[model samples]
Target: MTKIKICGITRLSDALESCRAGADALGFNFSSLSPRAITPERAKEIIEKLPPFVASTGIFVDQSPEEINAICRFCKLQIAQLHSEQYSPEDARAITEAKVIKVFRPEENFAVEEVFAFAEKSGINAFLFDAYRPDMAGGTGETIRASLATRIFNALGDSCYPILAGGLNESNIGEAIRSLQPYGVDTASGVECEPGIKDPVKIKAFIQAVRKTVF
Candidate 1:
């Protein structure tokens, strides 16, 4: 089965809703650049209320390992999603403790070889592929090519799952899953009424769509 992750959660209500909608993971954006950004304190509050079996992931960009670890520890996050080109492959590969998911936008000068090599060296848990939008840093609602994402998946060698993101909604998520057969699908703007807020109807429909996919 393909897992569903609802990203860019900002409020307790939205977080709770995503969890109730059967999201396996809830992503809290800690990147200061994002409109959906939330403080560790806020994320913790929401996470604390979650039922067991649901994972909380912290979304970070361009932070040193120290900063990333600090927030993850504070929020008790189960996973860390890194999406920065600033870190040398060495630095990124060295991170330990919580499961790490490195984000790659193939169209944004992100070399597939570089990502494959990093995963080989770092032993990350997964790779998130999102479309590259020049003005926006993430979740721009633009889709990555199925072919390129599949190539990255094949290169991972089963050690890590490739998570498809960007431009996913209830309508298209099933198609994306069928084509890429990713381990999971991530969405931020796709199920939102606006940044930081989720639309309940959309959230339910999105998860339903995911469950309908064969992976």
Candidate 2:
């Protein structure tokens, strides 16, 4: 099954709704730069209430390995999604508290070999591909061009688990899944009524759309 991750969760109500709507994972934005950013204490409270089998992911941008690991342990996070370019392969390897997912903001003609090499060097298996924005680290609401995403998926094959992000919603999510066939799909602004707020109806529709395509 293709995984569905509802990212930028700010409220326990929104987190519970996403899980009830069939999200396999929920992302808590820990980056202060993001509008959806939540405090570690708040995140921990929400995570504690989540049902079992649903993964909790902490999104980090520009934090050190030590800081990321500390937050993961505190919140009991199952995954640490690193969204910064500053992290070296060594930094990724150093995150011991939870599984690491390195985010890549790739352009149309990015080198696939570079990504594959990084995965091998970092020993990271899961990667997230989000649209590249000049001033933001994801949550751009811009779609990665189908041709570019499909090309990367084909080049990498099963070497890494690629999760597609950026500009995904109920209307176009099915088409996006059919094109890229990613291991997972992540959405932040896509299913939101506004930044940091989720719309339950949109969340349900979005997941339903993805399921229809995957099965």
Candidate 3:
């Protein structure tokens, strides 16, 4: 079944609502530039309020491994989503104790082999492919071609799991799942009234849409 991850969670109520809506995971943005960004202390408060068994993910961009480690530990994050271009195998290794999902910016000329090679070398838990835009690491609200994403996933062989992200919503989530059949799907702005603010109705509909695809 395709798992649902609601990203950019800022409030305790929103996080709990996401879990109630069937989200397997909740993503907390720690990237300073993003409007969804939350302090480690605030993330901890929200995470602590969540029911057990729901995973909390910390999203970072170009942050030092030490900083990532510190925040993850303090916020009790189960997964660290690295959306930085400067990530290296050493960085991944440094976070060995924490599950890592490395994000790849989909360039027009991106080669599948290169991404597969990196995933193999880093030994990451998964790969999240986000639409490439010069100024943004993610949360661009732009969807990449599913055919291209599927092709890359098929090429990865048994080395990595692929998670689709970027501009997914209740309307097209089923189509996205049918085409890509990703290990999981990540969303933020798609179900939000605004960045960091989730709309309960949209959250429920989004989860319902993804659940339909799974069966």
Q: Rank order by lDDT, top first?
A: 2, 3, 1
Give the backbone clash total of model 2: 0
Supply the TM-score for candidate 1: 0.92
Candidate 3 C-alpha RMSD relative to the actual structure: 1.3
Candidate 1: pairs in clash:
none
Candidate 2: tens digits of C-alpha lDDT, residues 1-215: 89999999999999999999999999999999999999999999999999998999999997889999999999999999989888888999999999999988988779988788889899999999999998999899998888888888888888889999989998988888887778999999989999999999999999999999953
> Candidate 3 — which pairs collide?
none
Candidate 3 off by > 4 Å: none
Q: How many steric clashes between backbone atoms does each model show? A: 0, 0, 0
Q: Which candidate is the best by lDDT?
A: 2
Q: If scored against the real structure, what TM-score would every candidate get?
A: 0.92, 0.98, 0.96
Least accurate 10 contiguous residues by lDDT in model 2: 172-181
Say which candidate scores most in TM-score.
2
Tens digit per residue, CA lDDT, model 1, 1-215: 88889999988888888888899999999888898999999999999998898999988886788888888888899998887766555666656646788887886344567766876677666888888876676868788776766676676656678888989999888888787778888999999999988999999999999997784
Off-target runs (Cα >4 Å) in candidate 2 are: none
Candidate 3 weakest ten by summed lDDT: 150-159
The ten-residue window of minimal lDDT in model 1 covers 88-97
